[model samples]
Target chain A: MKISGAQGIIECLLEQGVDTVFGYPGGRILPLYDAIYEGKIRHILTVHEQGAIHAADGYARASGKVGVCIATSGPGATNLVTGLANAYLDSVPLVVITGQVSTDLIGADAFQEVDITGITMPITKHNFLVKDVATLPEIMRFAFRIASSGRPGPVLIDVPSDIQLDVFNFTQEEEQEKNKPRFQWELSQLGSSLIDRAAAVLETAKQPVMIVGGGVVSSGAYEQVVALAEKMNAPVVSTLMGLGSFSSEHPLFLGLTGMHGHKRANLAVHGADVVIAIGSRFNDRVTGNKFKYAEGKTLIHIDVDPAELDKNVSTHIPLAGDVKQLVTTLNERIKPFNPSPWWKVIWEWKQEFAVKPDGNDLSATWMLKQVAERTKGKPFIFATDVGQHQMWAAQNLHIETPRSWITSGGLGTMGFGLPAAIGAQIAMPTKRVIAIVGDGGMKMTGCELFTAASQGLPLITIIVDNSSLGMVRQLQQLFYKQRYSESLLPVPMDFVCFAKAFGIEGTLTTTQEEFLAAFSAAIESNCPRVIIVKIPTEQLVTPMLKPNSPLDTFMDI
Target chain B: MGHHTISILVLNQSGVLVRVAGMFSRRGFNIESLAVGTTHVPEYSRITAVMQGSDAIVAQVVKQLEKLVEVRAVEILPVNTAVVRDMAMIKVKAAQNKKLEVLQLAETFGAKVVDISNETLMVEITSGKTNTDALIDALSSYGILEMIRTGVVGLQRGDCSIYEKEKCEISALFDTAQVEA
Candidate 1:
């Protein structure tokens, strides 16, 4: 039963139910890679370590399981920071394993050595640097437990080269079992008094608006949220992180609420009598001017993390527990109540500010609508990068289920879509996955398309080419008097050529018909494909609130 | 803005101090004085940070600190109900002519003369903020040579401790938060 640390890692991952890992190999991690080469676990070699981490993040979001990734020390580990922070902010479960220099060479400034655990301390839920081979199994177990447990996030396990090569008896199950740390937080501790208080508040509310967050998806509480929303007859609005928690097609579903949210959604929150904020921390973007946000309303904040209760906005009643439990309890205790008048008011607002697709050539909005229509009544996953296209997708895509839509909400990291799509597709092979990306964001991590093509992922990447950083350009046009400096991509890059170079098929579209044809073709290709839709640079995401502006105030285009 | 003294209990792990400081700086909160040291439990470290801000901002800082995995507890110690102290050592020129006066002033402030030179006297004192300020102010007249002060460190006056369960067991709260998937 004796095994090398490298072999032990593979064994540990197998025991944790990990079927695949996304990683890039390097000098320090060669032994681990060798071990993986001899094992049955699938290891995806991404173009960059960042892409690997992001792909793992996407897999976790899509599969509802802890995603795993591996990298070598130094720059390899540094590149994972943004992805780690993204997962941390969104509460995605991930186990990131990094290879370190030999134990003797750790502090000697040897080649490819860095204090990765120190660098990732604030970003990860927990981290460990294994100097002893005997402790590897236990630390690996704890890493998974910590990553998937309460307020799940990425955990780092730094395995030194020597430890990986060292031999240890792998049959010490009794000792390893004893080392497993017992996580104490339980759902039963949530007392009934708070549920009673919340029910009373709901009973008295006339215009209630429920704010669902990513916590619902992370905790697998989608049905519970749907039940509560239906029972109360409340309009459901979501934070950017909360996008897929409730079905976007639901009648009561208002679109994404915040800086670039629907005009009606923000207005609904402004006029709400009771704000039931579930699993949301009220990001600054969502709460424009904190002091005035949800003012004069009874705030009921329910979350798994107690620290987020009053961190952003004030709360009248705080319920700290799992979203599933709290939502279920509320569903059982609270009676159905109709807010038809408020619904009518919201309907009027939606009608007044409804998005109208223009007849412009290859419009991103129109393309998204076509994709939504063609994919309607079917299961699909849409992942997006940050920018105008991201907002457009969130505002236009027909997301029908939880974990069906993925985007970088907290960090707003660009270059996230392609790799994330790769991850999601890998996690769910039978479902259709699409990457809706902008020119600016695609350029950041477009190289990952090579991974999708090489693996024959059958993923479609829709590149919304506006030839500029659309979001920042819009900001300049609005606030800087149209002096767009350093906001434009110097040269118009062609995604078709890039896709071809990566061994992927690509098509350029300048009209609605062409886009639909190219999209349909890509869907039929059964291989990774890119459809570049040329959008006009002047187009902007509407209903954006200026920084420091009140929540109710927005500059609608 | 009023100054507030807050104590944080954290797992004795690497880079935890940097994480706490980074959070404060990133959030635009300024720390007036800070001290960190191992506590009664070797597994825990107590970080005493003094910041000047409104009640809401201070509360936000505390909540953010509590979010860190290594941070086990966070408690804001009110001045009237906590024992807060700062230690300082001041070196002053004390020639034969002014030695008596310096010694007398030091006596009134309960300062200890840890180092004495032919022409200088180094007095060390551990006391609250107000007393330390007064002693420094009085000693300034004698042309103080050099001085150093350890930042404020505080603990609650009653039986309640920052590490105690009922006061601030952050891990316990997190454990309770873990719902079965």
Candidate 2:
């Protein structure tokens, strides 16, 4: 059956199991819009392109599938750049389709003829410029495969205006089978060898520590990492990205290490004889002063991307493969080593770095804990924007499995949580989806609340109102001689009024009691709910390893 | 860390050097040296960078470079068969009639005496990294005053291009592969 390129796109999406697509139509993408109307796929029209892309991102992070977004060329495509880059940095799977000008006018500088494929290349996992109708099927399949594959990210498919009208004879099943190839983990073999080497190193070490990163979540290996740590009787220290990989309540948990990490976690990593890193890139922020970070320890880094290993710190055994597969193999092969002294020392460090907020009111940490408890063991998705709220959530949230906590890790994108939560909720309607955003980050994409309301997704948004870019202000206060630059904005917008404007119930809380009530109400609300918690602007993320310093060289709080 | 050679074809424009350099620095990819020059094509320039990293990371870097808007193509040339060269200009203090001896040293290293003044003698040398190091070693005894060295520029011999290899791999998988025809 011959079908238009636009219909081919719809067909390809349906074949990929994509039921929902978030987008706004324009003159350039009218053909695509018409095709979508005729097709069975559900399309959610967002008020803005930013909202559309973010909603798609939210859906992807929550569901662990490729989130789809469509937009016209020029401004529509440009608007989605931030979200694309956001997904790229955080490694979210997204398929973005943009309508381009006619193929003939592509380089003539015609109206709405922006080179979207080129513009998105740096920010996407892969991209294709489809000029012919016949190529659409294969390109679309390749786009989804690339976006959802190892180290998932955004993929852009720019469909020319002329091609959208052209006819093609291609069936969905034939295209899928032809395009999809087997992706095996040959790297896992290398990973197994490295694991044995790591075990050997661990056997001789007196104090061993496991440093878990976002890769564990990416690989759905959180439980395996925790089990491996417990088996080794070792303490677990996490990077900012590694938060939620280990339970905060676990006695072996040593909190986050690196810049803005806990003091004791930094000390634990610094003093350990062996440091086992899983699914982390070990960015400079995590290492602080690299010279002093884990100076005497043997660093064993296990990551899916072999490039990440020894890219930062020198490693003894570099394991390159899937984190889950590697951990599972390691758990089965090695005998549990007894490290009683190491466990005791880690326990001491945990006590020393006990993060007890001075005020008894529902602090950021307390709020996260409450949410974790309320959600129970049932699979729930938690998304967070950047700043103190994100760190606190990571430190406090009890994530039992992977894909549970989604945050902008690599990019540290601020306006990521709410839209991501909406996406997650839309992808899995029955799952409880929560987005934790700070005042600064909330305002960045706060308008996304309407998308959630319109979609009828019962997403719970917890806004930590700090009235400033808390992380930047804290840095300025600590590092820049207390000169707070443009970090402080004017009087904050009324979040409650903002939520009401979107037809979502909103509540404001100041004390711990009020927070508890508001949280319960928000969670219980059938419709999308927003709760604004007023937090102090002066509060700083403590136990920080100051910038340009080693992780272990943390300022003692 | 083994050394690797990466060739990037970028749109000829200003600030491209800074943009490319910034990417390497931001990603923490250590660049031993980088050289950029105009290609045979008027609108395009070729940038050659020599860096040290694991094979996996170098491949990732190549993929990242290929993604840059200004970058048209990226080729990772094997180090063994590639010819890597660097250019250096150094000014050395010459007292009395010692200029003849310095010129002699320059000639021995296949260097040319570009300029000669009463107080200083400038020598220009273009050679591989090893030869450059050796020349610099011999000139160090003359109390080198000022020096400028361009990073290594490398090119592979013959027609065995990286793009050709990639195309071959694709072709091997699907016999119908014919450059999107």
Candidate 3:
């Protein structure tokens, strides 16, 4: 059947099982909006393009589906840059569609025209400028495939207005067949040898530590990770992105390992004879002072992407393949190994340097504990914006299931939590989604409260209002002799009032009891609610690695 | 740190060059020189980039470049087992006193005099990067006026071709391969 390009886009989306779209329309994209109105798709109009993209990212991370977002050309597309970068860094699968000027006016610098593909080149997984309506179907298909495939990330499609209005032939069956997965590369023969080498290393090691990264969750390798850890009797440490990949309550599970990671996790990594790092890029935060990170230990790195194999730390055995497959194969080939003595040493370290709150007062730590206790045994998802609050949440929150924890791990993006919560809530309507934000992070994208209220998302926004860029301030206090400067938010606008301005119920709580009460009330209300938990500037993420030090070289806490 | 020559195979599409260069600069890898052109297959292009970095840095650069969606494959051209060449055009101030010597020197390096004017002579050479540099240096005393090089392009010294291998093994190598019409 012959159909307009707009109809083709709608048909393709429905075929892909996409039910909701987060976007804001403009003049150049009017045809698409018209198609959306006539179609059965649910469209969400966000306060800004940035909010729309972040929400889509959150939705993708929470629901394990490719989240979709749309915007017009130029400024609208430009606004999605930060959100796109956030998704790219965290490896969230997203498909972003931006309207462009008519084909003839694309390069004439037409009104609201921007080379969005060029603008987002470095940040997106891939991007395309649709010059023909005939190619729309295939582009849309590949956009989703590329966004969700190995080491998923965001992909963009820039469509001109004329293309949306042009006519094209559509055949459902043929198109569906055309979009089937085209390639599945088997594990290279070399991979088998690499796995053998890894198993051999594990066999000889007295102390072997398994460091699970976000890839475990992305690949749904949690079960395999557990089996491997159990078989080897090695303690498991997770990266921030790997929070929920393994049960926090597991006996072998140590807390997050990195700059703000748990002391036991860091010490375990330090004393390990072999380090098996899976699905992690080993960023600077994870490997403090790269020269000393995993220095003497034999490193076994497994990832789907070969690029990540030797990008950071050199590997004694590089097993480049799907984490799930690689671990499963290792499970079959390896004999049972024991590390009881290693566990004893780790348990002692855990006791000697347990993560503890510094003060007895109502603090971020105290508030997180209250939230955790209140939300226990409930279907819940939590996201955090970058700051001291994020580290505190990472250090304190207990994630019970995979994909239950979401945060800006790679880009350290502020203003991510609230919008992300909106996306998560939209994806899983029955589950409770919460945003944990610092005063500074909330201020950056606080306007997203309008999006939540308008959508009636039933999300709970918890603002840890420290009235400063808490992380930077903490760093300056430790390194710059406490010469606090622009880090402080000089004029503290009432966050409760700010939330109220967006038509959401707001509460300001100072004590632990008050916070719990407000939090429970918000949960019960089943509507968008914002609770501002005021904290002092001295609140810090302790047991941190000092500047230019090794991962094991922590501050004198 | 030393200069490393890297080759990349990418889809022949718009903005791919910028994407490759953008990533290089974003990761703080300085590009010493870069040359790009279509390969035997019109659907793909080859980019040869020279950058100075440690072994780790070079490995990282190749790895990061490979992460780009348009890129199909990335490999570091080994210095010993590869053939490297550069094309350069140098215009020297060849007044009456030095015209013969400049011509002789250019001929010695297998350079052709492309253009000659009253005060200058333009010499073109397509040779190894080192040899091209040598010719330019030898003519520097003759008051070289201007010079432009096409940068370095390299290929392995073997019957095996990276492009052909990728064409056949793409389905067997990458998890996601673009289906050709």
- Candidate 3 clash pair list: none
TM-score (C-alpha, index-matched) for candidate 3: 0.94
Model 1 misplaced regions, further than 4 Å: A171-192, A357-361, B166-181
Give the alpha carbon lDDT tens digit for every residue of A469-514 in model 1: 9999999999899999989876878788999999988998888889
Q: Pick the candidate with the highest TM-score.
A: 3
TM-score of chain B of 2: 0.82
lDDT of 3 by residue, A68-148 (tens): 999998899999999999999889999999999999997899999988988888888888899989888878887887898
The CA lDDT at B53 in model 3 is: 91
**Quick one: ranking by TM-score, best first?**
3, 1, 2
Candidate 1 overall lDDT versus native = 0.87
Worst lDDT 10-window in candidate 1 chain A: A182-191
lDDT of 1 at B172: 20
- The whole-model C-alpha lDDT of candidate 3 against the native structure comes to 0.87
Error of 2 at A278 (Å): 1.3
On DockQ, the stronger of 2 and 3 is 3
Residue A403 C-alpha lDDT in model 1: 90
Cα lDDT listed for each candidate: 0.87, 0.79, 0.87
- lDDT per residue for candidate 2 within A1-557, as digits (tens), equals 88888888898899899999999898789899999988589998877898789889877876777899999988999999999998887777899999999888879999977877667656776667786788788778777766765667798888888899998897766655656454455534555577788778887879888898877766778778878987888878887766767876677777777776777788778788898988888888788776667577899888776556666776888777667777888777767887888667766766776767646875777777778788878868888888989888876777655567778777787787887787778888888888999999898889888888888888889998878888889878877888999998668679999999999889999888898898878777788888988887887776666567755555554
